[model samples]
Target: MKRLKEDNLKHFFAEETLKKYSVVFIIILAVMLICELFIFNFKWVNSAFDKKVDAEMTLSGINESGTDLKFTSDSATIEYKNLNEELKYLYFKPGSNKGGVADITLSAVDEANSSYFSAPSRTVLTDVKSSEYIRLRFSGEVKDFKITVNGMNGKTISKDNIGLNVRVPLMFSWIRFLLLSLTLMLLYVLRPKSFVYNYKTDLSKNWQRIVTLALVAIQIITFWNMIHWNTGVLEWHKSYEHHRQYYSLIDAIKEAHLYLDFEPSSALKNMDNPYDFRERYAQNVAFKWDHAYYDGKYYVYFGAAPAILLYLPYNLITGNDLPNYIAVFIFGIMIMIGILLLLWEIIKKWFRNTPFALYLLLSVVFGAAACLAYAVQKPDFYLVPSLGAIMFGLFGLAFWLSAERKNEDGTTSLISWRLAVGSACVAIIAGCRPQLLIVTVFGIILFWNSVFKERTLFSKKSLKQTVAVCLPFVIVGAAVMWYNYARFGSPFDFGANYNLTTNDMTKRGFVWGRTGLGIFTYLLQPFNMDAVFPFIHDFNAATVYQGLTLTEMLMGGVLWLYPILVIGLYGAFKKNSFSDRRSYRFVYFSVIFAVILAILDAQMAGLLTRYFTDFVWIAFIGTIITAFAYYEMLRDNEHSRRKFAGIILTFSVITLVLCFLSIFAHTEDSIMKANPTLYFTVQHLIAFWM
Candidate 1:
């Protein structure tokens, strides 16, 4: 009977493992809940456990106006002339400016000594009209100290209406609990011995379609929420009005013209140098900003492809200007699909054994690594061209790869329609963002056998295939060139040189000196992190290069931000890893061309984070190719395969988190400014302790 009991116990532990481990997971979560409530957020626990108490001390200050102390300027200092007490919390009433929420930080010095300073506490004045008092946690034994408040944003903060040792409301942070639970659950599921490691590729076509559809659904929900800010409807405001350049171009197209409808002001046209920003400002001229002013006509200097393809058709059909957000949403969705399809096609061709989890992870990395989220976040005409180019680039490459099929003899044959479709998509990049035309050059290498080795100037089959590839380029190329020639008098000139904004682009020739700065800033710079909620901070673009270089705040380098991209170096450097030599060349050239484009963007346009869209996807896709290569290499060893997949999953999750945080960071047109309540709500949700 004892032996039978032991056998039954063994069966329960081994056969019902998930049931047993689930209980363990629940126990761990319960422990975490207790720790969070009792230890991490004990202040709230204490508040709940005891009745509320009034302030033990009150502080007052008088400004130069002899009024109750208010932050009249961008900054203010409040000094307690005499005070000696153990302070735990500070409170003050903040009045909003009605424009936007202000991020106010208070730094206090204890005992009038800088060395004995208390940690700074930041509070966002989210409610513009409410008379509620905001609280900041302060803990120190203090006497004769000063508190400095910064980032008033023109709002008045009452300093005299301040209280020390104030009791905060009972705060059971549900958000903190939810985040902890999710973290724990995710870690538990991805544990080394979990079934996640045992997952294998589902090779059925239906499974492939399901995976693609799942990604599409995720993209749909994500982009919808991002574009609408969780509101069911998109808000229309003055910010959209300023960036309706696409509508301007569409109106010009409706009138059978190439230039925009915004006529150049006579004061601006009469000036000898219309591109001179200071001269225009000094004269108070009313010319279109960022528009190409050549021969007194204002041209939308941004690529005309978005207008010609998307906005123009929508305007004609709907009899209204197409919103840039809609266009970005469409382009953004297609870009994600193209990324997944391209990756899927490559996986089908070469790395068929790649795990579904790895495939999902790399797909996400490539999609997010492209930084199309910036375009989605801003959703303006400026990013339309870049977004479209990446979409077309991915689709074109995917189609080109899909054209090849295996034969009965274990060789490959090319499909004509796929080649034509791929070439046409490749040619469209010229119309979208001409700088990204560099991607199309990969075609020659991709079709090395058909172009160089076969050398077909005649013969029926070869001629038909040749026409299949070249005809689309000819048609699209001719149309794009004609459009350019009609606008700029030269097929090659996209009219960016004549832009009447910022520096004179016509003379902003390439400087070799800027290349090093561009490479480091674009591809090598490490993330500047902080202890704050959104831990990642913008990379400072300050450099020693003494020149007029147009630089913008960067998030971080592509590699440092997405560490999985380092695997791309393995593919580029390793020659024997790939079974197909052409695939090897593709990876090698992707890295090479990405570097070249980075240098070009740095030299021509300077270092802007938006310009990362030009090459990051290329590097990311190359990395995906190599990551799968490494995964397939470990196919015989399940342990190594799981380890490799875990690493990819880990990096991918980190990258996704960083990408989400970036949208809320203090940057131009950030969500904090667009939707302050939502921003502060999420901020307080995740950072409840703060």
Candidate 2:
């Protein structure tokens, strides 16, 4: 009888393990299938004008077993021979920049009938440099596909050329899906436990584990995708194609040509030359977008970090440059992760016993709204400041939080070095985007009591420690000032005045009259949704945002998208809701700055959606903290069903809206449109709209 009971227990254990495994396995399997079948898209480039080609398609030969197709070619003999049993789409991506001279007369000697039914194949492929999609479709049976290029000048096309990638129909290529599937599958089988975070730790550790596991997985996917994606040259040429000074800076660096005094310049028609007044002028030497023309050289007004960090290292390694789109993607993942980490710290600090699930949910909302919905769209010139600001601010805040960790005995250790490190991170705000320097105040809020002893203004030890924290910031600040001085001849002037943009920055200043409207547009403007794939359309609002700032059609203000923010404002004034006064003050401090910074951005930067990324994070974090506080009240209430339900329903609605908002964030201008197959596939799923 005892032996039979033991056997029964063993069976129970086996069944439970299978159930756990099955849940995870199903999720993994769904992801694998979706990646393989659903999320497939690619971007192709021409040898000329690859920078602007928006639409791309699949590699076509991937099947159930595996992808059996591959490319092997040298500079001279370009070949994509069919090794698969089926004939796949012949996808050739070209150029990285908008303009390049590429006239390739290719002799396409098809082995089989390279025709879609009876329709004859397009014999001549001309204007390969154009940004618009020109189809080179082939549907019939084809075996070997070889193209011997009639080279322009002396450079023959490489069979395995750069900037050209194989695209599938969705957000990823088939080859990419196959590769990711195999890698993830291998990982699952080998280290399955690590993929799922252990939730048995303290509330803090639980959130940490969840974030860490997620970070590893995303970094792996993002890194793989970054390398595999057909990103054009990530260099001065591609990145600074419009902003010419960056390109010229790299040229000046490589050539060691330091010229300031007497170079002949082209002035704008008959206007005085901005660079050298001695020659013919082109009115806008800065040419396009927002660039600074100084001393006969074009300078990017964005930041120096992109050049120093991304472009330089990429050049050293790949013999090519890194594009802002690819750079933003890589940094986007980091910034997203960093933002989550920052949120976790704030949540833990605000409410020590906050549930891990709630933390995760809040992080999800923040990630979906900030990272995926808004920031991911502007992967071009905007990436440098937007993503950079997010990264510098969030991680800087996170590092500052780590400077003090409470022990089990309730004693806090002051790690002065971390404070310095944190300051160092924030200091680079000078280079990337200084607007986020408001976040640095959180550092002071975190470190203030320590910096000042009880009943005294300041302490000697605290003062010394403050110096340590301020040291890195001072050094980095000096470096940025020096960089500016060397380029624009003024430490204080970071070239904003010199920008040739939609408005003249030299004449642009804070308009107190328009700021109220700017604030209205920043967070309160309504979103417009149309009957389209990307359902969210432009906001047709009568705005007082008459100031000079370039922005897409408003997709509603931040408040319209996330209404739960009111909970925080309500919680702030509630007596006895917060556990402690210090944390409560900190929350308000962050909230005040967040809103103030939004106003500052509206005043300085104007009414752009991506600038919302600068401050919306504070609103998201504040809401989460307040919601936690509000929940504590409901937990202790006599009859809390209606209250709890109301809270849950409100949160539930926000979450539900966010899920759709993240995907259908922008119609017509949606990244989903990049993958026509995936876009249409998902579009077809919703025939009710049709």
Candidate 3:
């Protein structure tokens, strides 16, 4: 009773201290948020439009000058005339126009001295709108006509006097900023507050509270920074306009009219009418909003609906652009929560000590290297779902590995729920990225095998149960397959049409997985790849070298220590003395199998480092479990145990440092140019290689 009272008192004081600091942190964060609003000028609508214009201009440039541009037989030859002023417009016979204006320079060649015209000049034009055909009455004789035809047969026309204007939309600029501010204000008000202080009396409760607060903070911050809150402001208004433009499609649908019914004569048989054909044929066009609309085929493309769901009424009220960043942010928070849950489960099943739990948590959260890797590598979004699926599989295997399940009396178990949710998460992952279906299948098979070890192909009951458990996933998988088939005419076709046209087979084949060289570069010599180490070029190393700088290697190493621990646990399984050895072994094998499957899938075309991030995480978990299993081995020998612990700790620290350094060193040149100081600080502290 006395001890309990003392512990309670200690906890109370700690809570008080935490409360005091948390208050300060909240105030500071609030002030910072306000200051950020002012410091970073938000231009919602104009910026969005500006980006669109820039994209259009860039695309126009590429179409005009890129080597890939192909001219058809029907292309017309246009004439260029020298203008005395800084700006000049060239008139063309209007038709359903597809091309934009491009600047062309002309120079006269002299045969006498073989010299070109001096002062080779330049002219710039904007708003080069094109239309079908224009009938013009000419009164004067045109002179010095130089025709530079871009398409098949060259044809040219000359004109002298033309009009030009520099028109800019000033209203959009201010309206966008205003809308952005309103959205930010809404987000700020609804942001999570001092929930931690409410549950400070109990340590366990306090931990949960802290984690929740942390997740909320991460979500808000990520949404604000990563998604760019200002971008949403522009989207909100644009969405309405998009809906207005697509009203015709809706009307046609309501009238039970097919695209062919409305425009039988307008069927696009040539590339010239592709844009018009696409606009007419595509259905479910609620709003032709930028990337936000569910791409007519039911495949979630824009990720706007989910983002809007995050804030609900507040977002609707403020008319904020639905930023997909919210989804990414939430995904990241879920990952952190999932990790914490896994860690808690590990501690509960192994140490069962509060101090040990605290230590592990602190080490994970505050370890310099680990923190750096986590900050830079934005792996949480996808990693969490993958890890969650693995965790479910592991827990299911644990049920099968139970020493004497008959001895225990329980009709219902959490394992069933874990299996269902885990399988669903895996299905979701597969749906999001079809390639991951291979990993999901591997996990399901591993789980089944773990349950029915030597019983082979004849175990009907086990097979039935497994099938029943996986039915939901099968349905989801089939749905996804059907979706792919609908989109590309073949279930397995991954939209290779773009690749076919580009004719960049290197990118289409195995090079850099999707394009350049091949998966060999990443697998045979991961260290040499730009992803692992920016400077290293060697590819002949026999084993994985710490190609990353010391700091980066250390950080990444610490986070990945879980895989090593799993390996150690597997080795200990041979001892046959530990009571839970078999369970640990099962987990170890399952994780290893999953990793192998992930690696194999990644070795094919279209693999990336991020695609294999989940494997790294699962490997880490296995390592931790192995460490827990072998804890008693060290305790039995004090001197040896101390040495082992020191060595492991040192190695973890070193690896963590290296990981952090590797990620930190790669600066985002694009971001830095926009906001140099902020970019530099964040890049050094948290930005990941991706």
The TM-score values for the models, in the order shown, are 0.86, 0.64, 0.45
Q: Global lDDT of each model? A: 0.71, 0.54, 0.36
Error of 1 at 665 (Å): 2.9
Query: Whose lDDT is greatest here?
Result: 1
lDDT of 2 at 253: 53
Residues 291-314 of candidate 2 have per-residue lDDT tens digits of 566655556667766666666677
As a TM-score, model 1 comes out at: 0.86
Candidate with best TM-score: 1
Per-residue lDDT, model 1, residue 629, is 82
lDDT at residue 339 of model 2 (Cα atoms):
63
Candidate order by decreasing TM-score = 1, 2, 3
Residues 582-677 of candidate 1: C-alpha lDDT, one tens digit per residue: 777778988998899999999988888888889888888778888878778888887887787777777777777777777666466566556766
